[model samples]
Target: MNEALVLTWAFLLAFAVLAYVILDGFDLGIGILLPFARDDDDRDIMINSVAPVWDGNETWLILGGGGLFAVFPLAYAIIMPGIYLPALFMLMGLVFRGVAFEFRFKTIRARRYWDWGFIAGSALAAFMQGVILGTIISGIETDGRQFTGGAFSWFSGFSMLTGLSVVIGYALLGAGWLVLKTEGQLQSRMRTLALPALGGTLLAIAAVSAWTPFRHPEVAERWFAWPNIAFLSPVPLLVAGLAALVFYGLTSRRELMPFLASIGLFTLSFIGLGISFFPYVVPESVTIWESAAPSSSLWFMLAGAAVLLPLILAYTAYAYWIFRGKVTKETGYH
Candidate 1:
């Protein structure tokens, strides 16, 4: 029961995090793309594209954080202290971005201010998330169950690269989303922007891949071993296929494929990262089982998760289904 519950909750937590990153990622991407829109009208339409679903999209972030705190307190305690500033700043960024979304349309006098708030918030949040991920991948220094790293230990060459990579990745997702949701000149412009974002995203992936092995020999050996190679090779192959599809879709003026392809790219990357670090929840610092809460606690969490998680997914699906369409000047945000 302990074994099953631990694995189950871990998987649940992982799923929540994935959902948060992918769903919130595109809207944040849209916000990141705000500055580049041709005019105020274009900006409003772009905002309108995600207006219906952005807030609901963030529910997954809450679930992810809640799950971490509940099911893996030990890991959470260590991680929070280690990267407190980035995490706090990330939340502040989200707060400002959320406010911008609410106020960007209401007041004409401060609409421009709100636009900059949205853009800055999105970029800052995305960058800080990358820093968090990079710090994890690079491994946190811990004494027993507590973090021992310095205040700025999270800032490093690799972490900065990861932060940049995440920004570019989200922007790419946003561009693909715009291609799917906008029309005419905006669509063409997004397609043009996507190519470079795609290129930059791939470059960042390569840089991280090159640096990761030197940072973590365990991952290097797992990635390079014979049977593991056979098992893992498909991730990169599928990523390549999706990248090609995104390029082809953009060039052909295909609407949904570019966005779907970006989703595929993210999914594959998530899978690859999971495979690379299966047993470790906080990289080398903590294993999943070591960090898991008590079995009795997990039993309660599991029962609650079984009910709550499905409800979340149901509402999430319903939201996307309801909002599925092109964003235009005609479609007003309520």
Candidate 2:
């Protein structure tokens, strides 16, 4: 029962994360793409495209963090301290991003600063998230399940590279979203951006994949072994196929399909990561089985999660449905 409860929590945690990356990711991408807008009018449209749904989109992040803390307190306690500085910066970026959304519309005089805030905040948040992921994948320093890493232990060449990679990936996602929401020259501009962003994302993926195996021997062994290799082969193959599909969609001027395909590529990459580090939640440290809270505690929380999660999903779907279709100069949060 404890095993089942832990698995359930892990599954929910993954779901929340994937939802955030797919939903909030494009908006963050939009923020990253903010500087490229031709003028204030274009910027307004871009901002308006996301304004209605952006705040709601972030609920998944809160859910994921809360769920992790509630269901796997030990893992949370260990991992948080190890990546404390990056995580702190990430939250600040998010706060800045949220504030920018509110303040950008207020006046012509202050718009420039808010715009910078949005872009820097989004980029920094994305980079820090990538750094956090890279740091964990590279291995967190732990002494008997307690984090022992110092202030800059999470910073490294590989983590920095991954940070840049995430920025590119977010840009691609943002471009895809713009293609769906805008038309004419704005869409055309996004099209031009999308192709290069796509290529950059693939390059980042390749670089990360190449170095990941060498940087961690256990990941190398897990992936390169015969049966595991055969089983996991489909992930990369599917990612390649999705990348090809995204390229074709962009060439064909199909808007939503490319974005969906981009999501698929990310999904496959995440799945590969999950497979590569199956038992461990903190990479060579605490396993899920080892780090989960007491069974009774988990069961108590399970009931609340069961009721609340579905309502969140339902409201999210309803919100999207209400906002469906192309955005225009006339479209806005009001």
Candidate 3:
């Protein structure tokens, strides 16, 4: 395809990924933070905070994955086989959490079981996503057309560290959502969670920065090169500054701004990763052009997405508008 078309497609794919991370990130964060909730009341408050927006948030994931599958079939084919287990686990986690979310509020007696399921599902999903990311960053073991690696090979020490990092990242998002949507003790509790989660996330980013390049020399070189280095370096700096702002906002009791700032941090970091691995879809294995489906197929998929994606975005915005306000004890999914 022409360069302009390629670039436009790339940008759309990137936006979809960013939307997924920001939208689903918070609900997953809520799920991760569920276990730390002190009691049933706290849990209810936490769930309510995300109920209006959680499902809509997941639309980004669908958009991102579906867009990639349509536009870049080769990348999808290679990466899917390599990370199949983790991908399946992530889906299961999301499904489990989604099911538990509805069931949890249906009956008082079954609430505890569903709550635990939500927590487990959220944490599992987050960790699996991180692991998949780490595996991609660490380089997948692919031999020509297929993944030659063992089944459990994706679960390494480095992958686990990335998983933990994601857990903290989600917690930070959850904390921010709570800051925006709740008040009183719950807000205070979220603030308490936000600070440490922010610290852990930063540390994880640092570690990943160091480890990723060491593990993959090409990526390291791309990052350290003069022009690329200068262009991409601002991402981390922005992330750090936003993180500090988030900390300050939380400490000063600024409320809603902390969540916004946290989202900024996440967005910047995500952009950095996207920039670092621009042309490549499956780490070192496949480039976007190489893995792209036929032009005719892409055109067809693009047409469908053109209609569906906007409708999803509009409905999501409408849902958020409908539920805009502080959550209360009386307000819940019954």
Candidate 4:
């Protein structure tokens, strides 16, 4: 495959992953915050906050994995085997969350069961994602195109910490989302939640930054390298500044800006991670070129994406436009 084609496919795959993380991240955050809700009313408000957008958001995750399988078959092959257990757990969580989402609003008798299911599923999915990410960042043990690592190797102390970080991060995003989508007491409650969530997220960022370098010397060297350091160092600084802005906005009760700032902070943090592992989709193990599928396969996948992606974007935009206001009891799905 030519370099131009390879880069194009890689860019598309990256975009899909970013979109999934940003879109689904907030809803997952909302789920994480479910246990903290004061009552059923609060829980309903939380569910309504994400109802119009949650299912649409998951499209990106589907696209991401599908695109990777089509365009980077080798990376898919390598990662699936290395993190198969966690991946299955994540998928199961997602399925449980989806089912709970619909059933929670259906019957009062099943409400409690579905509510807990949703929360558990969301936490499991988010933690499993973190474990997969940590395994990738920590490097997989492979031999001749096969992963030779233990089945449960992804679940370690560092990975668990990262998982908690993701939960906190998602909570902050959820709080910000609630701030934007709610009013009165609910908004106030979300604002209250945002502060601590933001603090926890920042601490997680710091811990991960400090820990990652020591865990992987090559990664540490890359961060401290001359030109790369100068170029990439601003990402974390920007994340810190945006995080501060989010806190300030929340504290001052600037409702809209707080959510926007939270999104900015999350985006910046994602950028930092992407930058840290620029060339490797599987962290230290496989380069994009090494893992990419044949040029023919990529072109075929691109043809489908050319049509499907625009349709997904159009529908998502339409849904948002249709539901663009504070949700109320009367506004919920039947």
Candidate 5:
């Protein structure tokens, strides 16, 4: 295998996943927050805030998943079976949420049911995604390149904790987004809501940080080993700084900074996770090089990605640009 090509594909795959998490995460956060809307008008404003760009945000998800299957089939094979149930549930939740997005606007009488679907679906998807993350962090059970874990291995106390953490974290994201995009009572309410959500998210991050190191000694060694710890201490420090910035922005009623800072929190968390698990695509078992496709296949896919990735990025940016600014009652996507 061409090491450079394989590493290139790994980096691309990671970038796609991160983009999906940051983009789709906010809209999913919006959906997770649907039930908290004060009334139908509030709900409309909240949903409308994301309506134009929500689906577009999911494109990165497709890119991430597709890239994994294409570029690292071996990792996909082992990891999918390990977390198949959660993955399936996540997809179903996303599908139902998408359906709710469309159908809620079309019916007045049935809107409440669709709204319920949206909330439930969003919560389910976010929680399942967290479960999958926990399962990955805790490490998969593989025997000779095959998943050797039981069907229920993905369901554990730690995974549930992670699931709940993601829910709270996403709610914080939703609250911050609403704070940024709405005005009047809705904005005020979201600003108020963001305070507690921010606290919960920070707590969740701390809990996950505390729990992750115990799951694998190597993870602890990676973070706490002499020179390594010296180098990585800044991640948690930055997290604290971002958390403080978010708190300040909320208290000061500054809209954009809170959202941007919340994003920074998530970005720092992602970087921390990357530090924990590098080179290993399947965590403890399969590495990027070990699981990567043949050089010829990678080169061919690289050509396609070279064209498609830029187009994806271009249209995604265009959609956001076109839909920029506050979504109001009079000028919503609907």
Candidate 6:
């Protein structure tokens, strides 16, 4: 295997996953927060704030999942069985949410049902995504490319905690997005919502950080070993700084900063996760190099990705650019 080629694909896959997490995260957060809206108009505004971009955001998800299957077949094969249930639920959630997004506007009496569907779907998908992450972090029970773990392996205390953590984190992001894109009472409400969500997210981050090092010796060594520790200590410190910035942004009514800072917090956390499991894509067992596809296959995919990725980025940027600004009664899909 060409190490550099494999590494390139690894970076691309990571980029795709992070893009999906950050981009789709806020929309899912919006869906998660839909239940908090005071009225149908408020809900409509909330939905409209994300309507134009939500579907487009999921492109990264397809890219991430597809890239994994093609580029790292072994890791994908090992991971799928463990996460299939949650992944199935997550997709189902997204489907219901998407259906709600469309049909909620088309009906009057039935709108409430769709609204609930959206909320449940959003929350389920976010939680399941977190569960999947936790399961991966906890490590898959693989015996030479086959998942030897029982079916219920994904359901554990740690996975549950992580699932809740993701829901909170996504809620925070949603609240921040609302703050950035709404005004007056709605924005104020989101600001209020943001405080607790932010607090919960921070707590979750700290808890997970503490737990991971204790649970995984390699992670502990990666973070706390002398020279590595000295270099890596800044990650947590920066998280603290970003948390403070998010607080200040909310309290001071700084619209865009809170959302941007929230993204920074997630980005930093992602970096920390990458730090914990760099060489190993499948946690302790399978490595990127070990699981990588043949160089010829990687090169073929890279050629396509080189063209596809830039176009995806371009269109995604275009959509957001066109949809920028506060969602109002006059400007939404009501």
Error of 3 at 313 (Å): 1.5
Residue 121, model 6, lDDT:
94
| Residue runs of model 6 more than 4 Å from their true location after superposition | none
TM-score attained by model 6: 0.99
lDDT of 2 at 324: 78
Cα lDDT of model 6 overall?
0.93
Pairs of colliding residues, candidate 3: 74-291
lDDT: the better of candidates 1 and 3: 1
Report clash pairs, candidate 5. Answer: none
Which of candidates 2 and 4 is the stronger one according to TM-score? 2
Give residue 212's error in model 4 in angstroms.
1.4
Name the lDDT of candidate 1: 0.89
Put down candidate 6 lDDT per residue, 9-117, tens digits, no spaces. 9889999999999999999999988888989889989999999999999999999999899999999999999998999999999999999889999999999999999
Q: Judged by lDDT, which candidate is best?
A: 6
TM-score of each: 0.98, 0.98, 0.95, 0.96, 0.98, 0.99
Q: Show pairs that collide, candidate 6.
A: none
Give the top-scoring candidate (TM-score): 6
User: How do the residues 125-174 of candidate 5 rate in per-residue lDDT, one tens digit apiece?
Assistant: 99999999999888899998999999999999999999998888888888
lDDT of 1 by residue, 1-334 (tens): 4787788888888888888888999999998888899998899888899888899988999998888999999989988877888899899999999999899888999999999999999999999999999998888899888889999989899989999999999999999999998998988999999999999988887788879988889899999988889888888888889999999999998999999999888888888788888888999879889999899899887888889888989998998889888888889594
Q: What tens-digit string does per-residue lDDT give for candidate 2 at 139-206?
A: 88889977888989989999998888888998999999999989989998998899999999999999
Q: What is candidate 3's lDDT per residue for 1-334, written digit by digit as tens?
A: 6555656677888888888887888889999988888899989988988887888788788878887777877777777777889999999999999999999988899889999999999999999999988888777788886778888878898999988888889899889988888888888898999999999989988988788777778777888888988987877788889988999999999977888998898787777787678788788778777777777777777788789878987998899889988897889666
Which tens-of-lDDT digit does each residue in 1-334 have in candidate 4? Answer: 6778788888887888877877888899899989888888889988987888899999998888888887888888888887888889999999999999999988998899999999999989988888877778777878867788888878788888888888888888888988888888878888998999999989988988888888878877888889878987888788878988998899888878887888887678777777778788777778888888888877887788899889998998899889888887667775
Clashing pairs in 1: none
